[model samples]
Target chain A: MIVSGSGLVEALRAGRFVVTAELGPPRGADTDVVRKKGRALRGWVDAVNITDNQGGFVRLSSLAGSLVLLDEGVDPVMQLTARDRNRIALQSDLVSAAALGVRNVLLLSGDHPSYGDHPDAKPVFDLDSTQMVWTARNLRDHGQLLSGRSLDPPPDLHIGAVENPFAPPVGFRARRLAKKVRAGAEYVQTQLVFDVGAFAGWMAEVRDLGLHERAHIIAGIGPIVSPQALEHMRTKVPGVHVPDAVATRLLRAGTEGFTEEALRVCAESIHRIRAIEGVSGIHLMAFGREHLIPEIVDRSGLDRSRFDMNACGSRERSADAG
Target chain B: MPPPRAVPTRPALSSRTLYRLHRLLEPNGLYRFVARVVERHAWLRRPFTRTEESVKRKVFGCRMCGQCALPVTGYACPMTCPKQLRNGPCGGVLPDGGCEVYPGERCVWLIAVERAEAGGHAGDLERLHRPIDQRQWGESSWINYWQGRDDGLWTEPGGRATPVDLGLPVLVTGKGDRER
Candidate 1:
């Protein structure tokens, strides 16, 4: 009765809204921070996502971080990026993740190396995000490689992809999302959304294109902490625009109440997103403020009953009793 | 000569034809196809090239056009053309026999060495060489060709499959052969 990839899919189909949280590991090789984060959020969130050198900054490998989470009895969503590894290394890590019972995965065409701390580092885009999702799904279903050789047993993985609606050429983003769906993306977690109306418009398009039927679309929500951080996000991060009103509110609130104001905005945004017809869930990227996830979820008025211990325990009991 | 076996007419170009032509103009299709197919089917895609190489040889080697232009001149094109070594070898092969420009496999120059020796033209192997007329075909024309091929128009005479003679010496003008 363990929640497999298929189980997640089934849950989505059954109108059960899924929630996932990000776990940002420390810069060095230490696992204690990741292990602690994983342990804290265990059984609370649907899946604990291990980020891959987030923001193109250096960090422990997502593979290693996910492995630690897996050992800690938490379901891990291994984030695969085309930034660091070629197809060989990417596939190798994916197989390893599957073997270790990490069923869910997020395929990302990570930020360019120029955006990272190591600007000189080479970016290996052997396969983009859409291709990565297709690759994962293919490995899970057909047990084969691109060369058409057969795997002994195909890995079972829940393939997910990232979507950014705020990106320029908005139409291009929509088309790319559709392409990702065609490429076997079973779920899409979008870039952190500040404009609920824009997010809703995107969801409507997803419904129009029949993407909701093919994949579970999850809106990304990042809680703002300070005016400086908000300013940095708007100016620095391409494709991420925090509306002037939200920025004004944060600015007016001053440093004392910035965190509270940010949480409220995130909570309201999540509530609005959840109300959208095609939205299946929310991905809370609290940046380094991982502790704020539960608060955001609570304030968003989301029913955690599906992930509640009693419900999970009963489902297990029923399966066992049957 | 009773109509000389009706030279299998080249298909009229279309979008698909253009893409196929684009693919054909490249060194190898199987590797490209394999790369694409593997992207779509990761479980079946393997890193090792022995099986892939055999597949390429069987399916696309001589059946495809660009392979003939490969420096090896015997085996199928390795499809490992490098950006830096636009001409021939800069004599920078690594100790591992891989190209300094492209790290994984044998240098194109090194492969050409064996090929030149086999072909009894070892002397020609030492001279720096460039690729033969590598022009990107027109997209609209390619699509028309593809459509023609798909619709069986390529087999019919005067249906745009006329063999426009491409005069030879196939020079490697850095500007590419627009004249041809």
Candidate 2:
């Protein structure tokens, strides 16, 4: 039986570290992908984020995918990147997403059109992610639009953001995250935490500034269980700082047993990440290998007490049983 | 690739022309002199102000946030960018120096890099700069420059201060940070 599970906000507010998964919308109008993925992640993830034209390429709209997940009895966080829309469209979509039962929103400065399938498409970053975050909070807390016009009933959204612990001028990342917290981000998922030591240093500053109390810091992880995945992320993904030592570990895992080693490596990172004081939870990207998450989560044993999986009334519905 | 759109070159004498008239006027005391001359007479200042708006709107996508940084930005207005980004290019900048929004034309950041290179002031441009103060919106930035209402640098309208006394904490700008 399907039932409305629990809100991520409740989990975080109650001091339960939360887990969220990202689902990239299909390139075409195939609702099957959304349905299949949504059902798979139903109970296991606290929330599922429907990516909006991620990488600045055209895809099935995030709104459509979000609705699909919502129907599957799994809550969704609509990821809105400010690459193709101006403030007006952004505000409109925010309202629409909330109206459609989306309780969470993740703001992003999307990839350039050149990075996606349609390099010829015009990009619009009318409000960068910071401004977008501020604007979203304004709509939620201030009950107004970018033009300062009032909304009769504002949309309710729990805002989240992304951070890269190793971006250049590393000293200011904590400050930047602080600014985002002040702007309206209630939670932050760092760019994949490949280097646990580096991430711990970044976390030290976050704790120093007392931002962890204000924003739930979720560490990002994905099983790059292959030598090819390691090479691709290190070379292709921007702002992802994969140290040579981590890459070499994966390469030495051997091709036949690489998947197991990769899963172990991810689990090890999770094991190490859970030891960090300020971290609230973990975000598993798990692009093509969603099936590995259950075992990985069980193996890591970080925040394994989210909800019960048997009953929906007194007990929590199964996160994977949908 | 789409054919590049014609970006507006600054007028020969406007505040945005020479490295945005920021550094040039800053060191030479030209900013104070020009500001005083405008404040000297509303009659004289009004017409000159009208011309700056009309001309700048065409040549530079001037949002007139009261802070000018042409000298720092290679004289290409950050306001023209679809994102209106202040610190630097959002990760979306095309490899060809074309804008992510208008791929047919060069991004303002590309132009800023070229100008900064030409002026040899790239190192100095990364200093802690403030976000725009909305009070000066739609006003003449050249006048604001003289009045001292720069990005988050002023306390109120028509305010000026010593750089050492900005009071606001420093925040570094990132190259790939999309929220600049």
Candidate 3:
């Protein structure tokens, strides 16, 4: 039986063109920052993903940030990485998140600490991303831990895993997703995609495997916001593939009109991505610029009406606020 | 001997001998006897592990993970990956098939994938490898494998391994575990 634990899963299962966005928790112990970002993302997206120390920099815990989002009536997809925690801690966090009402989890192997602030920190990749997915599924379906111990009441979660079509061994990326699916990933959120042609080609292979029928494929898209950010993501960000054409266009746009041009590119990309066969949704990652998502979503010409907001718990919270 | 003189006996024997050797190495059948001998002598553990380390480190760049995955990973040591990814390549493989952490080097899993596909053992790549047993680090995996000590690391034919098979104690007990 499918555990429709989160509205994100429900929306996807109902064939709604879902829109999800990322929220980076602040580096300090500031709940207000999370709440503000959560509020900005509230109606614009179906769910907000609380990053788990994204980029390996120390920040507020993803669990705390997710709880803040939950308090603000924004559904949170709590990302759990295997880099920091072992299987025990991960399972503990999973059950804890469930107890606190966070139902969506996007499992990742996480960025190496060498790329983050604390390069000296010890990495505990006790489990890889696929193993983490299998752990979560084991908890949900079998009501057992990886050790096979029975949980009196298992933490019900919607399993999501990240895929990067732009990465090397491109031919094997689709098959990797197949492995994730077999491991029990119900949905897949891809890494930042700047080259639609490459993505479409990858999607063709995914179609050949009929993976789209088994899992919801959400393409990752984001506004560059600045030429510096564009370059950083293009060159510095691991697994993020930004083609030379994007860099050239952003360079031509210059600083004065870069944000507009970047958003225009993003909106246009969304239009193209929407038309791509088998893409169930778009995961907007507007790094540090949550306010622009509404404008980007509006400009993308995607029908927002398909998202039934009343079906979610956030509607009740908004009503209370009113 | 007279009948064998009619044919080129050396080529036929060489091919059959090579095939038998290959079959023997597949399960490390001969190594099991060596492992048992090493197991009986407690003093040989460190030396055996060090020897294994020197040989594998030179060839496969092995990290002495103790739960060796080389057979399934096209003989490429997955421990060499910056992240030590066992199941497959992480999403961070560079555009040119470079490692994410060390872009100059090719991603180990990518090499594993290509080699496995080439060797027609591509399905072996799909087998989900569990997390490494940290206790087994720097130990002799050959002896561990022969003794069935690392059975938990390898996926069972039925899919996931049970805790009993993994040799994990029932750590989560009644009231205290649920108290949280």
Candidate 4:
């Protein structure tokens, strides 16, 4: 039988500290980068998340990118945002992800269209993130769509949603996560985490509400490559909170010392964030710094696991699996 | 927290003017005080309630989710948006301010931002709004405000229902295809 779900799910289920990485597809039609990243990340991460036009910029569809990674023997967590697609398209894509052998799905109320490449293009937020989670739950556990229509075989999908731990009202973030879980999120990938203390507090609340029991909370970590990059994320991203110390360090790095501090920041975040009670894993959304994964892994000093042939993917299990 | 059922506010204050009043009263204790008075009032509530409902629905496309965020949103009403966006505009808003859902019309969030900018309450627009309470539908929001229907109240009510209880079930009334 095929080992279902995704590698990330397996690691979480096993109570292992999970590591997942993001793979953003290029704007053009090319699977080379996707496959390349897949191989580079194969043993390093439990799963790879393909962003759907991240930051409202146009790129290859996550579904197509996921297929490329799937072909390359990488577990791709296809992200479906409500910003561009409506319920029909979203549900259809969810079904297609299973058909295409993609097991993990991350649902988001995508950023507004105005933020993206085609500001002239219309948005289609048919459902918010909460409702999308509910819709997915109805389809998964109930084996029926929100309309009560039955499916021949419910897709073996592992549903996930995004949470901004530091988003205010800070207290409501946990409640939103609870709602997402109740609506059927098996895991949560949060906004970039720089404030570890705030995350620990959020995790405490998640544990208090027993949300951590139901959903695996994976914290998002990223390396600020440049001071400009740091500035953009801090001001433009709605819920992300970038700390001043990181900013000051990055500014002091002054481009020459950039790499060392950036690497340290990413690694230290993983180390500190891993200690949080409810954090089941770390999601490295090293947005533009995919090449730095090796440095991140080295600095974190965390246990690493090689790819399991038994895990779902096209790659056959063998002695040389890693 | 339903009121006496026969009392709704009859302030002779029109909702158009009332929206402006809310903006003014929000900082002071007056908004809550007015809400309490409206909740406790007794008599001729039906006509007043009906007028209030129709006017708000027509002018603002109010879903009346029991939490009125109009004051913070520059009175543009996030609830007026098709997605009922409480936080901010989704990335789907067109450059010309057209609705991604309705199309050919202005995005409520776009209008809200313009209002916020003009009113210099842009920070208020960025403030997070907890999910709306659907159970308060059809009830006078004025009364709900007094009862603290949503978290925007002076003090957040303790022990509210979890998101599991809050993320209501889909009605599936066949509008599923339209949202696409």
Task: Identify the candidate with maximal DockQ.
Answer: 3
**lDDT for B153 (candidate 4):** 21
TM-scores for every predicted model: 0.63, 0.72, 0.87, 0.68
Indicate the TM-score of model 1.
Answer: 0.63
Per-residue lDDT for A1-322 in model 1, tens only?
3444324555565667777888888998689998888777765677778999986799998889988887766677889887688666887778888877777889986765666799777666555565566566656655655444556677777889888776533433564576567556888888888888877777777788788887888888898898778877875664566788889988888999999999999888876776789788878888788888888877877656555543544342211100
| TM-score winner between candidates 2 and 3 | 3
Model 4: clashing residue pairs? A56-A116, A111-B91, A112-B90, A112-B91, A112-B92, A113-B91, A113-B92, A114-B91
Q: Supply the DockQ value of model 3.
A: 0.28
User: lDDT by residue for model 3 over A218-316, one digit each (tens)?
Assistant: 999998988779768878989988888988898799899899998999998988988888988889898889889889888987656434344554332
Give the candidates in order of DockQ, highest first. Answer: 3, 2, 4, 1
Give candidate 1 regions above 4 Å deviation.
A1-10, A310-322, B1-180
- Model 4: how far is A120 from its true place, Å? 1.4
Model 3, clash count? 0
The digit string of per-residue lDDT tens for model 4 on A151-234 reads 769888888988877654454457656656755688998888888888888899899988888888888988888877788777
Label model 4 with its docking quality class.
incorrect
Error of 4 at B180 (Å): 31
Query: How many clashes in each structure?
Result: 24, 7, 0, 8
Winner by lDDT: 3
Chain B TM-scores, listed for every candidate in order, come to: 0.32, 0.63, 0.71, 0.62
Worst ten-residue run, lDDT, model 4 chain B?
A: B2-11
lDDT (CA) per prediction: 0.59, 0.68, 0.77, 0.68
